[model samples]
Target: MKHFATALLCGLTLAWISTVTADQKPNVLIITVDDMSCDSVGAFGCELAETTPTIDALAASGMRFHYAHVQVGNCFPSRNVMFSGRYPHNTGVEGFYQVRDTQYAHLVDAMKDAGYYVAIRGKVTHSTPYQPYAWDQDLTIIDGQKQHIKNADSYYRSTKLGIQSAAEANKPFCINVNVSDPHKPFYAMSSKGQVVKDDNVPSKIFTADEVPIPGFLFDHPDVRKELAHYYSSVRRADDCVAAVLKALHEAGNEKDTVVFFLSDHGMPLPFAKTALWHHSTRTPWIVRWPGVTTAGSVDRQHMISAVDLMPTLLDILDLPAPNAFDGSSFKPLLEGGAQPGRDVVYKVYNENSGGNRSPMRSVETKRFGYIFNPWSDGKRIFKTATQGTMSYRAMRTVASSDPVVAARLQHFNHNVLEEFYDYQADPDALHNLIDDPQYQKEIEELRAEMRRFMVETNDPILAAFDKRHDLAAVSAYVDQVQAESDARRARKRTNKSPQQDDSLFRLVVPKQVQAGQAVLVKIRHTLPKAMAEQQFHVTLKNGDGGRVERIVKTASGDGVLEIEFDVPANLKTKSVVVSAFVGPEYGKHHLHRTKGGIAVTQP
Candidate 1:
């Protein structure tokens, strides 16, 4: 305990936290379920009876948000927004891939710096900026054994452990308990349709006939069976929630702790998981801040995004929020006050789990929703996690006989460039009113709103939006974005050290260069001011030192330095390493250095 305090004292940088005593600070407990829709809870409007009794109870005792949405539909990006108070582009976590060197401070970082004991349970990798996060306690593993994700009691034990450990440390607790139920490999069935046995069982198991089909999906027997499994998983998730809250009560911190409950995103199904539709981003946001929020209250007047979670919680604790946050504190809304500009929310999706680039942007209001998909060029197939589901398979089986089903499948495979939904009448987003002349005025208004959001956030796909009417311009932008995405994936794969991301310069070289041909080496940098008067020293050398070339050039005013070197015809090595150094004066101690590899071919 003494060592822990000493270590925290050494690392803690928030000097303002010292003014508040440990008892004055409230514990923060965030309970998140995976792949759950907002309508899945009975309190929110799940037709399936008792699907989430524990969550419904929490809503009854807390403040339920009726128009809460996540910034993204996928797991990692959505959870990252909840913690970092930033959009996917700002955090560089646009997909499932890890962004090791994030410029933003996370929720845990703020809580820990404020003299709280931070911990996490499940979704350990997805929730944090990177894996092996410096949590005061990782409840995922205890006594050298990893807790089972599906087991409801595992969460109870982990929560109890976190609370007791925080008590021992004499600090407020901020623990994120992520339950893994309601995701894929749901309750009773495997990834394949085979039945499976598990020790952890839901209190009430659902049958296909009893479960209600979501509005976004087709009504099929296979889909019904899948929904049955999903509902059963939701029930188990309810049990996990009950267990966690019970642990909090047992520790006698129920009133002293502020509880937050929400799903990472909507269901993991077609048109619901990865797509920027109504159900994709809508989340059941519940907050139980004792002594602050009125019980049994619902906030339907304001639309909140998951991005606001970080700043709002920090505000609740009276902690200073980082200036880089894209989200503002909704503490006023939670305190039964009104806030303007709560009528709309902005959403984005960049890449999927498989590293496929399908950039999308959207804006949603109470009555309308508009989405712009730059990657949908009518040729590139959209890849997502939903294609592997039973519902999609059922759609494929019936597509041959049903033209409607066939069209739906094709639309799912290749989306159109733009989509507009009358959300008031069609919450499922079943119909696209992009060409409806009656709603042209409303559609134009939504487009203007989306454009404002894109410009405000500095969205990368703004060029595509600006030239959406021109297919050629949109196609060019899409291609450029895809190439950049591929390059980023390659860099992340090869560069392990986070410091490599801090390099002021970037070197771009072709894969192969002829021995007698002129080779071009491009140096890119963001430090235009620092390199305005500097020079670039470029060198190309082989492993055996049989061939070497050197060139020096002044930095270009456009932040890109292009240098050409002629390779010797007598070059014998199969490859060469290209290195570039930027400095005001030529010397070994330069400002920045970058390297790339190129292959040598005989001409």
Candidate 2:
């Protein structure tokens, strides 16, 4: 993706250098990491045992901003805003939609036009091309099991490759190494707590008790174990960061290069990665500008977003900040001077198509967070998130009888009230104060403030955002595309004996079913040509309630089982089971008829 199709010259030759301020042009380096939260760093008051020496060293040399945030909470949208210097809505990519270049030039193009040898080393935004015209070179990567760039070194190598090319051209370079660390499967490179692949991967997993599993989770042991696994990945990320800095030092660019280190967004846990809440969207920004920003300085006063970064770099380099940017330049603050920044920085999301869920947009300040849900009314229909290998998703595979965690999972899936948080009293945002009488004034104030931001930024949400199905519709449509992809794969597999197969039984709901409506369960057997007809009992049970019973099972076709019954009128969300116990239950695969995430909305 890094080969430029053609060169766009800003004509920054040493001869042309006489036309610009000679002392102001500084080389820029942007390093972005994956799902990392404030909890992993010591600077954020996280009590971690391992040393984050590289990140700590970087912070010690420059400034760390405690209140830095992202324009959106999710990865694709955050990258969109970061690249365009605009809001996610304005970029026409509320979530993972393609970025339209006509609306905004990428930061690389802008910086390149200003005569900088700009090159991208890691996951470049898909909204733009990996063509030669866009970047000087893109370095190849060895993907981790989870299919993202593994660590800072994965990116550093790419950047190093780009640096070699830049040297051949006699160019001063602006390099961006987009690192992927600290994201998930939660556990690093393995299923168990063991590090199977890279010896660099952390071996010991963190537990919820070890790291404060953000309150949004049920505060359960399982969730804590998940948190520990996530922190283990963070420890490995720190080591990777150390490797990158060492490369810069070895290359003799440590002092001259302006190194900016940060994650695109927060963690991949509940209410963190995809949501617009502070824990998800807030970025941990640390910049080391050798002679400019003071060493070991922590700035908590200013509110800055990733979108503000490009313009800030432009300003500090004595380049004109593009008028199209929605963010203000913060060169003064970076240069060791102080000026008043915004009281608030707005964040939003159209949807998280990856998680197969709803749309959410949140506005946050030092003290408050207000989310606008376009699907709060529950009238929307979306694809079930549990369609794949995600454990949280696979758990829904047997939601019936798994009431506690299932309901919590569904609460997130279905989402809750129009979210409003008092960061002061409910920093973890456990209790939503959106409709609370005591917080009415605060909610209204935030609403008005967000409205002004929308107007000023020409946000498309200003027109589309409502107490309707805006977010759900957009996300579901994308899910429809994904579902089709899954469908294609599903069709290819010949299920000769799915009944006797090792994997559990699977079923499909052809259409939406509602409360008190008739639900039909159809099961098929994939047997070798002769072993088609098999006797199997189909059972139905409410996964959440204690009720368990067999549904109508008048054994039918040579390779099929079908059951139809009137669903309970009062049931809001429930799963049906079709398990057949053969030979005293020593060996039998559990076949499940799962719900297809349909909301039977009240009139």
The candidate maximizing TM-score is 1
Stretches of candidate 1 exceeding 4 Å from the true structure: 1-23, 492-603
lDDT of 1 at 59: 80
Candidate 2 regions exceeding 4 Å error are: 1-24, 125-133, 141-148, 151-156, 186-200, 203-209, 219-221, 354-357, 379-410, 464-603
For each candidate in turn, the TM-score is 0.78, 0.68
On the 0 to 100 scale, the lDDT of residue 405 in model 2 is: 58
Candidate that scores best on lDDT: 1
lDDT of 2: 0.60
lDDT of 2 by residue, 1-603 (tens): 101101101110011111223554666788777788865676666667652545665676668888889877667768767767777656666644343355567777787888777666555554242222356544442111111366545545556645554565567678777666676554444543343565445434465576764655554454556667777778667655655555564576655777788888777765567667778777778887766677778887777888888777777677776557888787788877777756788877655654344555677888888987654445554332222223454345435656765765665566653688887677667677877899899888888887888788876556544323465554454455447545544553442224545332345443445556666767654434443333445544432222235543433233455667566665433343334421212223234334433334322
| Candidate 1 C-alpha lDDT tens digits along 143-262 | 335689998888888899888778877898999999998998898798876679978888889999988887777789999989898999998998888888778867878777888999
